[model samples]
Target: MRHLVVPFALNALRRGRSIEQFLGAAGTPEAPGIRWAELRPTAEGFALVVHLAQDIGGEGSYDLVEFPSFEREDGEEDFGCQIAVVDEPLAALTIAEKRLGAGRDRWVNQGMAGDEYRDYVRAGRPPCLSASQSEAECPET
Candidate 1:
């Protein structure tokens, strides 16, 4: 089994839902098992790197999974999983994409702009800032 880096961003795991739950929800029947290595918090949010054993068939076929922290109906901690189509060598790209997707939404909703906003995106090390940037500023990158 090859070691595939599965990037995920989650809360402190102190809540009722843990990373394991997120993985189960995101994983497909064919998906290989994952072993989490690190879960670090960044300026934007948390960063998770897990070693998984799976066969990534081809480009655009691999699934990049993410689980963002949320609150459960019972006021307990919860998370929701999201999946994305990714290319080969999924490690860095998966993390970058998750950060971009999550960060972009946060920025747009908060109306963040200027250098501070730029720095925020930069911190995530996104694969292609242009693709994740807002329509107005995307062409500038």
Candidate 2:
């Protein structure tokens, strides 16, 4: 089975380190059809975000679709899955892993980005999901 995050990130998170990483489409960098995930402490609690790239069009630009989407209440617009917020890091990590595994094929995680993903986590998980929003705040990156 394809792992959601690398072993290092998973182990680090289990040990209570806040980190983020993405795995998908090797050699494409931030091109369309890439997926990334992050686990960090937030004001509310530990937050886990797994986002998939959706081609929004315009010069290789794209948007993101958070995974593990839940059903909205009646009359609510189905934008995407809500950022999973939990009181514990392990809980968030579990959900993140599950979400990533569920779409393993689409994510195309060929295990080629392992080293780069580790560097990304060490770099404080810089925003690298959407090239179109490089200047904008990555709420979901």
Candidate 3:
């Protein structure tokens, strides 16, 4: 997936404004519809991924915005410097880790599980592909 890093100013979200209100005041069209999932602290300030209409011209535009964080001393504002946009799950995972320090344990566990499943399918005698097959019957990778 392509990763695009851009600058964004998101002082509004850091100011305790709801995601909807922030997006509304940020000039994002309401018709396209905006939905917030969660906020994770990134290297800059915070990372916010909002799902919007795919029909939008910049369907996957990554806009970076600076926002104020309470952690700063003297009420200093933290700047959001980088924004990354990507479509691949793996790429997204990597970006998340680099940008937000997100843990990769979950992703690693999922990959291991998928590998085991594939190995079982490929090594089974007579190749049992049915989901009803007993785990004992499947060969280990």
- Top candidate on lDDT is 2
Backbone clash numbers for all candidates listed: 0, 0, 7
Worst 10 contiguous positions by lDDT, candidate 3: 18-27
C-alpha lDDT of all candidate models, in order: 0.27, 0.44, 0.28
Candidate that scores best on TM-score: 2
Cα lDDT tens digits for candidate 1, 1-141: 111113221222222122221111112345422211223333434433332223222232323232223333468543322222222223323453443322312221011122222342345422333333221111121
> TM-score of the candidate numbered 3?
0.21
- Position 51, candidate 1: lDDT: 24
Query: How far off is residue 61 in model 3, in Å?
Result: 35
Give the Cα-based TM-score of candidate 1 against the true structure: 0.17
Cα RMSD to native, each candidate? 18.7, 12.3, 20.5
Identify the runs in model 2 with alpha carbons over 4 angstroms from their true place. Answer: 1-17, 26-31, 53-82, 102-141
Give lDDT tens digits, candidate 3, residues 1-141: 111121111232234321210111111233322111223334444443432121122212322121112222446442322235443344544554454333333222211222322333344312222222121111222
Q: After superposition, how far is residue 82 of candidate 2 from its true place, in Å?
A: 4.4
- The regions of model 3 sitting more than 4 angstroms off are 1-82, 106-141
> Model 2 scores what on Cα lDDT?
0.44
lDDT tens digits, residue span 37-121, model 2: 5566667777765444432222222223322222234554334234578886657656655654422222222233344444444
Clashing pairs in 2: none
